[model samples]
Target: MGKKSATVVLAHGAWADTSSWGKVVVLLQSDGINAVTFRLPLTSLADDVTALDKVLALVDGPVVLVGHAYAGAVIAATHSAKVRALVYIAGLAPDQGETVADVFNRYEHDEKAPKLAPGDDGLMWLAPEAFGIAFAQHASPEEQKALAAKQLPISPAAITVPVERPLWKDVPAWYLLAQHDHMIPEKTQRFMAERMNAHISAYPVDHLPSVTAPELVATVIVDAVRFVDG
Candidate 1:
């Protein structure tokens, strides 16, 4: 077998903590791959970017920066030259001039998602009831409850703030489109992937495939590593 490849630093989505990637991390490590998950502060976009930057700096060699869900904006906004590739997993890959809010507004999605209202602390989060349907439909009931308990509230200001620099434009990109995702419509994902000119793969899964379908997610990530190596 070829030598073990570069380290992978995986970032989680809006409501999730680094534990969201638990299964994927286990699978990657079983193969002797070096991987780490960044525990994003889920505060402001700038703070999230800073956390990812710290993770990138810790990588010993070339790195494949992986982002899930909202973290696509996070990774693209704060990448370093040491990153060899990017893999967006059922995530939003916005451009430098675009904001996650702009991307969401452009797409006409079902409004079933719980209305997000800003909190006293200026952070926004999913309504407790919306968690089961919108965010954890694919996970087991226990998993859903666990995720709900640990969900982090983010600042609403972070959503509309466009990325200052999107790595998608500067680095090679791979997108894993979750076909069964109810949160991010497949149609919108296609549009974003096309706009970004990414190499795309389709998966018949929900938004958190890295949690519910770890093996499949790991394979997609491994494929991206191979593509970058070539």
Candidate 2:
């Protein structure tokens, strides 16, 4: 497969899809780096990890896996030796035997997250109103509506299951703390960074930095890669 191209595989968070990355991917590609954003199944932790592994297997060279929100846990479980680094964007970076729910309940149990309840199909979906405030406050009113209309449901099991493997302990990590993030409170992001002992950066953007501040977010991810490369 020729020389494996250096790549950055972006994993989107729950309640969103690969398209949520939008301009952030463009910015990374503009830097002469290969950037790929994969759609998360968001159905179960095992399913998300399997999907990421499939995407990683397609990559030719060293990779940096970037995960947002719940995909942070997804990346942790799907990590491979080919991956050079990890970037967590206001996401969960749970250790082995640690669940997102455990982290949330530890830090701020009452924090306002999307009302995630299980469905008859045994998956967790967000309440529609959460799309406007929790998921897409930065988007235009119409844009938010459109996103809410197509939001993917996550599995309740994914939230409560601890990562079977925690890659952050092995790989170089970059944590971008969103100061104004409502979905995964700013304090919670900082706490995760501290736990991971990650290379830290910050933005005043909301939970979805890829949409609100793509340039800055991309710079953070790129900078992390360059730091490791150097």
Give the number of the best model, judged by lDDT. 1
lDDT per residue as tens, model 2, 1-230: 45554688999988888888878988988898888987887777888889899989988778888998888888888658888888998888877888987765555523556655688988777777776776767777887776777777787877888677688888879999888777777778888898888988987887788877788779878977786556
Please give, for residues 8-85, the per-residue lDDT of candidate 1 as tens digits. Answer: 889999888889999999988887778898688877788889999988887777888899888888888874888878
List runs of model 2 lying over 4 Å from the truth: 1-5, 109-112
Model 1 stretches with alpha carbons more than 4 Å out: 1-4
The CA lDDT at 112 in model 1 is 59
lDDT of each: 0.82, 0.80
Compute the lDDT for candidate 2. Answer: 0.80
Query: What's the CA error at residue 72 for candidate 2, in Å?
Result: 0.4
Q: Candidate 1: lDDT over CA atoms?
A: 0.82
Instruction: Give model 2's TM-score versus the native structure.
Output: 0.91
Total clashes for model 1: 0
Native-to-model Cα distance after best TM-score fit, residue 62 in candidate 2, in Å: 0.4
Q: What would the TM-scores of all predictions be?
A: 0.93, 0.91
